[model samples]
Target chain A: MTGAGNSALLSIRHLRKEYRPGQPVLKDISLDIDARGLTAIIGPSGTGKSTLIRCINRLVDPTAGEMLFEGRDLAKLAGAELRAARRRIGMVFQEYNLVERLSVIENVLTGRLGYVPAWRAFLRKFPAADVARAFDLIDAVGLDESFATRRADKLSGGQRQRVGIARALMQAPALILADEPTSSLDPKTSVEIMELMAKMGAERGVPIIVNIHNVELARRYASRIIGMTGGEVVYDGPPEGLADAHLKHIYGGEEFL
Target chain B: MNAAAREWTRFTPGERIARAMLYIVTAIAVVWSIRTIDIIPEFLYDAPEQTADLFRRMWPFDWAFYPKAVHSALIETFHIATLGTILAIVLALPLSFLAARNFTSNPILNLIAQFIFVSSRSVNSLIWALLFVAIFGPGALSGVLSIAFRSIGFVGKLFGEALEEAQQGPIEALTAAGAPRSMLLVKGYWPQVEPAFWSVALLRWDINIRESAVLGLVGAGGIGVALDAALNNLYWDQVGLILAVIFCVVVVTEIVTSTIRSRII
Candidate 1:
């Protein structure tokens, strides 16, 4: 059913995921993502925050539900259709996940793998335009041209995360999913990373969905916040509306607060 | 303060008895093995004298024979090793992917690939040479085939292990980016395993050189053919010369391959 004024880029209805047969990680989750704002999914460890983000990208397949993006159900897509859909959704991992032996530029170039021919990607012969765009994106991510030729393993954690961000943006994706994008970084670097993500999301008009454990950082950067506990959403509202009572309910203890 | 702090070093009676029994059992096994193998003290005492007489005959090695016979046989040995290593690596590359757990999750394919590796590895190179010699009627072709077949298992097993141990993070990232299977292999997996692949190939080549040198004893071709002839004709000096050549070749191959491996890896 085509809609007149629906701005939702992604619509999830009754999404569920279970790694084990009887125990579910995500239980009947539903949400709608607009086209241009940062949404943070905040929760304690062992919750389904990461699972919900991964389900959108199909990195972790759903047990049951509908994930509608670009007018197609992501959960039902398979093979070539799944791949074609995946290319439009960029994912940033907790570990940054840059190929360690590859140079920074090569890692970023991998983002264009879906668009480039397989043989060309194998030989690492990216088109001139893609190379130019990669350099531009690297610069946008606050990394210089010299860092582009350096191998990924040689870079520090923060620098590698910057490369991760550049690589994700190079896909020119419609949506970006970051699973604990700043969890491994120090507090200062975490703030910088969150700011960079927020600015990039605004500039590119792409919705950013991040699964984070840091509540303060989430409140500081997230335009909209989704609080979850025990594999179900406990609260969903703007960051300003997240009260201490909601935090106590979501985290299940007052001492940490 | 607490009952004079019981001593930790003292062993219980049962532990002490078990330790004594372990030593007694080891000693008995060693003596039994010596008797079973018939390692006579008399033969051991006579070995030095016999070795001295053999060395006296082998002195003044046939330096004049190096140009015509020894040189060509040595060249043939090198050729056989090179060809065999190349063939083995070409065959092992695809088989390694099939054997890797991450690549081939299908249990039947993994078992089949693992079986090929086990079968090839279980047969010694000399036995492979003997079988090939019978089939091909004694030539360098037999030596080459034998080396290749024997090496396939070793290369495949090591390379497959390297693939399995590669970091999963990059593979997941590539998959999420919608990269196909080939792209995931080349861009995601190949870079991580490149050093291991090179190291294994060089190590296998070094081993093949030594194996090929001895293949000619079975009439499969190489310097071993010269050695076999010298032994049959009772040419002690020529036998010494052939051995010296083999020694030099092996030492040089070891040095060269190690240098390359260190530089690359």
Candidate 2:
């Protein structure tokens, strides 16, 4: 995950996604993200920030666009190639979407599922190195090592999100896409999660793209900012360049800011 | 709604007469059937005394007969329940898969699977035992087969609903990550369904115990055979002993199943 290419780790050109046949949700959005840094996409709900990041991993298919990752076009690939691409890209979710009944360690190991064969994972027979890596990540994420044996259902919202981040890191991904990862947490936990993501991204030199709703929080943690509105990019530059007028344009109201 | 429509609440003269006529017709039909069948209301009042006298004659559950009743007959009851449940599980798991709308939403397959389930469950267990006994010999095999057939329908319908309703969040995540179909079942589906599987299987175990106890009455090998023989020979004491043993078995099964259920949830 370190220093694959210091140049823009992920590049996009003319990305478009339409859930319905004629009505487009994301209209020809394009942006580039550098490695080893935090880039935040901020906007109101349903403005397609989530859709734009999901489109990078092909969780939602882009209707039309070219997404280039390390000189490879993501839109043109299919089947195994797409899966291989996903293995290199990790995702953190808003709901802290750990498998509730699975042990915390089991949930983290799911990040390694792309690399491990089906039968091996089924039998819970992961390699010693992978198992040790999962333990290391759990510890690094500030979770008690004993928590690995407990089911994910028993954890509080903040603790569960920590496990979610640990799972994403277990993949050793070159890029991380977080879809409102801190929205479900309390204010303090949200800031802590933001700090954790920034720290993890810096340590591993992985390009991290997060969709956030809190503009101030984004400014605090992100080196770069990409604001979206009405399925298109409204602003893209350094965090300092994201002014009050730009926020008004992206959210359609200046009073809140 | 409208003022005029709201004002018109009462029935007219002709409508009232028509309703009275329908009631009179229904009364006449009921009276005729009662007469045809020679209805007797006295049975409800008179039978209680006679039933009490009969019970008094068979007092104390014939405690002396309990020892003989505890041996091979009890063993046979366990066998009937075990074999029946195994057979039911074999047929039920696959049928449950087909019946799950999520797995097999095809109209033809869904209809056929449900039809098989409904047809198997339409008759009572005793009726099934009777039919199987008439077809096969009067033995434990017939009783076991009958109980299994009834259980297949019950477990299949319940477990199918459980499978269909699995938390779709995990499955969607797995598919988004390009997991194969089998991996989706193991990772996304099985975790949600495990508790449900336990509850259903444990419930079926208790039901099979009750069924197996009575299955012997059709000449299937269990304690019910002893009860049937005692009743035929007018040995009320022996019949009382068999009933007592059956009660003990029911209570033990209740305790066991409840314990298992508590652990699962």
Candidate 3:
């Protein structure tokens, strides 16, 4: 296990989250994420996988924890400070979560909302460089130039996920968090998405923390794998070390295996 | 139980008894209310004769009255509705944000906004006209103010509901992208609700036109004053002309509005 050394990009200590007063979803958890490469968190449904990623971004507030990122405690920030922290962290969702009524280019430009002024965003007058970069990122994610002007609702599931990836990359973020980014796609598209994510992470040198349900995809794409159950990390090692016993421990059944 | 032998057509004993009781209660209430209101079936016998007589008196409409009394008043009615709807939209824009659960989040502000919508909607537009007439005195000012106040509740209520029913997925995405509240409102929410907002605005304008036409009955201004005068003086021909102009205006407005709506949405 990586300790809270100088090389760690983010260091979390004894993190805990509870929606209700007493019933905690994430128990006291601790981990250190490096600065580059893909790390996959695999677990069953309703096991606090989404909650853990949301907590890192402060989308779900931590009941008790210390999340140190860029020399500040993320769990303790509020208002502008919290927003500033969030700007550096890009998030992708299980659903594409694109603004359906907005054009593809406009959705991509929304990633710069934190840096741009409100009036500019309202008028859609992003800076020239931002616009140029948006087009570039759209291309980077395998979308053609014509797709930029189309409404998001008109795209296929795979195409929308490609847009989702472009939108997240537009932020120029320090870290990326993907909550089931490929769950809605077919097997072929899912593999393509995972490959694109892996390639993007490698080229950009930004670490990606992905919460996924498919163990095979995680093994194929991730450098490291963290197996979780009941809000606790049951297994943490290289993806090759994740075997049938670890899967049994994480899923609590051998019928499917 | 066999796969196909069980009964599927009959209600249980409790359900049958409850349904029978409901029918009996409804029947009793209807009879009691009818008796209490003291409606006489005999009075309806003369309705057709009275309607025919009124129609006969109103024939040969006074076309000359249009340029003098009806035209300017008709224009004033249009002005009242347009200005009133614009003002209501301006006021309702923020009020709806306050009323929406996803937007406001504070219970107290939500309650206040909802209370304002309910109270404004509870009063009839004529009652609002009456109140404004007392306060602002007669003429187009009172009519405009009355229409604005009456429409605020309708526009605000529907706009708030639209905001509430908007897809949460994009909002979550925006929040995750570190958008400010204002940005969330404009980029995240505004695009989703734009069509609904325009539709409501057009529908309210249509309603206000019809409403403003009647405002002059209480001296609040518009063509209603001409209508009241024609009725009082027993100039049935002028009244017929005024009604015809109003009908034409309303039908044209509806056609124009529906066309715009279809094109935009």
Chain B TM-score of candidate number 1: 0.91
TM-score of chain A of 1: 0.97
Q: Highest DockQ, which number?
A: 1
lDDT of 3 by residue, A28-55 (tens): 9898899998999999998999999999
What is the per-residue lDDT of model 1 for residues B1-265, given as tens digits with 9 covering 90 to 100?
5766765657788999999999999999999998899878898999999899888888989998788689999999999999999999999999999999998899889999899999999999899999999999899999999999999999999999999999999999998898888899999999999999999999999999898989999999999999999999999999999999999988999999999989976
Least accurate stretch of 10 residues (summed lDDT) in model 1 chain A?
A1-10
RMSD in Å for all candidates:
2.5, 4.9, 2.3
Candidate 2: misplaced stretches above 4 Å? Answer: A1-14, A62-82, B1-39, B62-70, B102-115, B134-136, B176-178
What's the ranking of the predictions by DockQ, best on top? 1, 3, 2
Quote each prediction's TM-score. 0.95, 0.85, 0.96
lDDT of 1 by residue, A158-250 (tens): 899999999999888999999999999999999999999999999999899999989898999889999999999999999999999999999
Q: Judged by DockQ cut-offs, is candidate 3 incorrect, acceptable, medium or high?
A: medium
Question: Number of clashes in every candidate structure?
Answer: 0, 0, 0
Sort the predicted structures by TM-score, highest score first.
Answer: 3, 1, 2
Q: Return the lDDT, model 2, position B130.
A: 90
How would you encode candidate 2's per-residue C-alpha lDDT over A163-246 as one tens digit per residue?
988888888889988989999999999999999999998998887999998888899999999989999898999999988999
Better of 2 and 3 by DockQ: 3
List model 3 lDDT by residue over B1-265, tens digit each.
6956776858879999999999999999999998899777777788899889888888989899999989999999999999999999999899999999999999999999999998888988889999999998999999998999999999999999999999998988888888899999998999999999999999999999999999999998999999999999999999999999999999999998999999978
